[model samples]
Target: MAETDKFAVQPHADATSQQQAHSLEHWRSHTGRNDIITGLRAMHVWLALGWHDIRQRYRRSVLGPFWFTLTTLVMVGVLGFMYSELLGQEISDYLPYLGIGMVVWQFISTAANEGCNAMIGAGSTIKQIRMPLTTHVCRMVWRNLVILLHSLPVVVLLMVFFGHSLTLEFLLLVPGLLILMLNAVWSGIVFGILCARYRDVMPIIGNLFQVGFFLTPVMWRASDLKERAWIADINPFNHLIEIIRAPILGTPIMLEPWLWSLALIFLGFAAAHYLMVRFRERVAYWL
Candidate 1:
């Protein structure tokens, strides 16, 4: 009878161990880090989806994505000419500066603008599918990156036409682009959550972007604010643009902008991680 009791107790202990392991798995699965890791691992899904979005959007159009290249050229030509004249800057010097800034700003602004809808726009899939919610945000950022690439040829042409030779500093654009994309990811998660919960915030973001364009020194030079340099120094967008723009224009890369950009990355990810973990499960319902 004692032997029988021992065998029964052994099964009970095994059951309890299994239950504990299951609980541990569940806890880890619910973490934000897990979500990010799983989402990144599912890159094939987001990559295909991002490319599909671009192809579908320009499906019937003849020029397709090259339209971005043409638009960049016209925008730079028209604005570069007018702004250079009005600001009393030489055209040769100003065009390359304006072109690089415009291209970089387009990526930053477009990623941000679309990021607001990252979760909301994928509403149907979110409800029906059980994937990491961050996947949608990654898709949004990747789509904007594609657009950024399409517009890059304009930057190359501008540098060539304006006689800005490639220097070792031009390689700085690689890391600058990476940092920009990382910032976009966190911003997408944060803004995506806020806009999903508060629909009205979307239009507010749009308006802010319009004002930000003029305020951020995209068209205007930061050096023009000589006496009151604090204005540009205070704008985070200015630092973001400077990181990429300075590299392309072969200007001295300032350590301050790099510091600010890195600081923003850490702070932004902290906020994003909190919101993601807190609301990851509820995002589908919010959609």
Candidate 2:
């Protein structure tokens, strides 16, 4: 009777130890860790995939990714001409504004839209393999950035046509681009997870971007809203657009826009990081 009782006690102790070990690991993986190291380590793999995505997208096309540039160029020209006449703004004044705005806007809009589908789109891969899930978001953001690079010639052409010279201020665009790119990373993760769990969110966000096009000052000037100036000031989209656009056009970068852009990035990255650490392992199941 004594030997049997000892045997039972030992097994119970061993079982509890095993369970505790597992719980420790489970909590460790789910503790909403705040770190960039994992994402940084996975960068090489996502960079390759991002390049592949661009190539795969335009594989057979004659112009390749420049197709986007041409399409954007046409849109800028048509809109710039028509809107300039209607708004009584100079063609010279409007063309560069619209050109830069549209190109950067494409990057912002698509990065956000693709973010919603990043995890879902990579659903098969996520299920079949074990990997850092943020890689998907990284790849999507990089791919959009590649598209933005392809559209740069359009901006250059617009600047040439408008007889605008690149200024010391043009260098400001580098930081602005980096800031938006940072937002893209967080947007991809946040939207990817949310859309994976609730598929309806994807389309809802798509429609919002469509409405946002009108609300955002992508093609329009904020001066048009002089009486309602606070509207542009309050609109996050306008500030985001300004960060990139003001640099390209050699205009003053407002303190308000810079403050807003930084705030969005800081908050966005914090939220995305928490969601990633908490839900990353569950993304496959959500998909």
Q: List residue ranges in candidate 2 displaced over 4 A.
A: 1-36
* Per-candidate total of colliding backbone pairs: 0, 0
Models 1 onward score TM values of 0.88, 0.86
For all candidates in order, the CA lDDT equals 0.86, 0.83
Estimate, for each residue in 85-174, the C-alpha lDDT of model 2 and write its tens digit.
Answer: 998989997888888888888888999999999999999998986666777888998899888988976687678767887778888888
In lDDT terms, which candidate is top? 1
| Position 135, candidate 2: lDDT | 75
RMSD of each candidate relative to the true structure: 7.8, 10.4
Clashing pairs in 2: none
Name the TM-score of candidate 1: 0.88
lDDT of 1 at 184: 93
Lowest lDDT 10-mer window, candidate 2?
27-36
